[model samples]
Target: MANIVSYLAREQRTFEEEPFNMVDGLVMATLAYLRYERYDRLPARPSEPFRLHDVLALASWRDLLAGSWMRDAADSRSFLRALMASRRYRDAFVSFYVSESSDAVEKQFSAITLTVGDGCVYLAFRGTDGSLAGWKEDFNLCFMDVTPSQQAAVAYVSGVASALPGRIVLTGHSKGGNLAQYAALCVASDVYGRITRVCNYDGPSFLGDPSPRVGDPTYRAMLFKAVPESSLFGMILEDGSDYHVVQSSAMLIFQHEPFSWLVSDGDFLYRDGLTRTALWADGTLDGWLKTRTPEQRAQFIDTIYDFVAASGVKTAADLHRNFGSIVMSVASSTAKLDPETRAFILDTFKALVGVVGRETAKSIDPRTRIRLPRRRESYDGSRPADFARSLRPAADGSQLAEAGKPSHAEPDGLQLAGAGGPCPAKADGVHPAKADDLRLGECGASLPVPCPSAPSPEASPAACGGVLDKD
Candidate 1:
């Protein structure tokens, strides 16, 4: 079925001609997921706004989008190539960009600005990447009141809006969409009023009821949200706000992908409401969440994160790759946790298992589940391994990165060192914190301040990166 990529390839209308619609927003959101941090040809904080044509002029779509999306890498790259070439966005200015990722802290946030010369600028916030996918986001959000990413979103918009005098529009896919609305609600009144619209495509909602904080008529009038008929990500902890339903080409959990959302005539194929299975899944999630207090949920996520960190598995794919080892590692670590904490974590998974039993579960990626020997490494010469080798953990478990290098890892196997890439020798004395700063320079934080720090090493620099994929 036709999707956003198809729309980009087919649509020639400019913002002046047809106006910016949800389809355009989705394309921008997907482009926002592109990891510009990897290319040295482009500065992280460009002094002048970078035009879409400039990006297309530098690299082929494949190099620009290598290792961007965890799920729809090919489709996303295609969408990007078409976007950079399309008359609609070729002249658009993309600036004030920042992207950060830290396994040390379990959050990934990034945003970019798109100026289409239409008196409006789009603040495209990134959603989750491969590392922080559907399940990780669901678990981590249980305890966060306002994540560093959300705060950064507020600050990011505030900073950009203060600098640029155009009408503001906030949009994102997945968690990014959620941030667009959240930032709209929380940003200062003047900036909030400047925001003409906020588009949320399949992004989850906040931890608590946000209605009390939502006081602006501007916000209410500008909000636009859509979810797939069988969404799992969008419905999680939904705020009971109205949203349109769109038919999807994917099934059940995977319907969270905007690439799968059916598009026709520049709009989604509308549905009346979520599918019955989606309602059940949403109810199941709500029930499980209610069963645990915020504190319990927080503790449970912490416990799991602590376990994974201790296990020395860099990504979730690491756990699945050597199931026996992970099982043993988890067993050993489970004994360290207090009985209450262990029980809580177990109960949460127990509920998830129950939900899965009602419907068959599919693995995220089959290749990630298996280990490839160094000799067996394979790729089209561009993918996760190149990025992974750049950010591979140092002797002390800190990620050392070079500026403008794709020094990041996908929790899925693509980031595995075996993906056929040689790590460049590090300049002497690359501290994790310092390396983080360099990487941050390659991928700025986009905010005036660091994203909220998770509890950890006293010196942990606030981490941020160009996070890809919300689901």
Candidate 2:
């Protein structure tokens, strides 16, 4: 039942008393998601560092500015209120807030520096916001090593490191976590030497070799990577840094939201490693990425971006306003893609599903049965059903939440948790050639599978049921 809000509210100990730990790192990283730039009282670039208490005194949850654009805006506003009222963080200070969203370069970057108790400094980079541009940057990470955001992060860390004197920690959730690590290594030696830790909370790793910016051999010691047991975005591409899994209360992709992570007396509930499904997913994804050349990645990614752009929606707010129009725009756009690009999308999806299906069969107990929800064919052939409405299993009971609107704090897709009776044998004249033809998602029962947008089977677990079902 405990989360960061409750933990901080009850916490009387200062940073000096308790010292910084995984929990503190997670907390700071989560705070980075707040639209700090929109809060005018917080110091911006070239401005001297401002005390956290002073800023909180002037700012209210009403002016936090997450309400219009951020996913789960209400929860985020409440979280900020908790932080502002916390006794533990009164000594913390903030400065050098920067945020940029540019469609021309397909980049969305934001970072803030928090100097706490004159001892520890956190350079917190934000992950994807509601912007489609933000999501595109995440896609860019799949092919490129150093994103524009990463470069900005490096500069941000270097610019503020000397001015803010402390034992520095580069920290963030999602792509922000990726940025933190990237900034740590890429900064000058003086700045790198001051960094005591780099906390990456469920961030993706580089697809290509990041050149000329490697830190000293000590970076491995500085790393503290934690991902949920059923991580998807965190497992993208290939990662060499060791990471441990943490238990999450929520299922599947929603686990990427740090708020869903389960906490104990003073720390996160730890697991040995990723779940069987996650391991299979990461391996499958790495294999899939390794097969494609960088050129192919760029070409295919551009095609996908085109579809998103065609929707004419910019941010999560826009998504909420015009869901129907956006869907229509995306569907029409998909049909206009060159034949080769269309083939690539379909061929790639089939191959990935085949691999996941084979893995599921091998990994699970064939005797067990999993009842999956039926698939309706409303998706544009290019769009997957995984991004649609989901009936989430909440703590109290079932609740409805929209999928693929952007995550609460990271570069993760919204989860589509559809649990129901059984699949219809016929395709409803919508999707003629389905993955069910390949026997893609079942153990023994012949359920007609409706395809979900799974990079691996793990991405959309509820829709593609069988081996990954918890019950």
lDDT by candidate, in order shown? 0.65, 0.64
How well does model 1 score by local distance difference test?
A: 0.65
* Candidate 2 residue lDDT tens string, 284-346: 666566556666777777876777676676776777798788778866776777888778877
lDDT of 1 by residue, 400-447 (tens): 443233344334322334456432222221111100110011111333
lDDT of 1 at 141: 61
Clashes of 2: 0
Cα misplacement distance, residue 335 of candidate 1 (Å): 3.5
lDDT of 2: 0.64
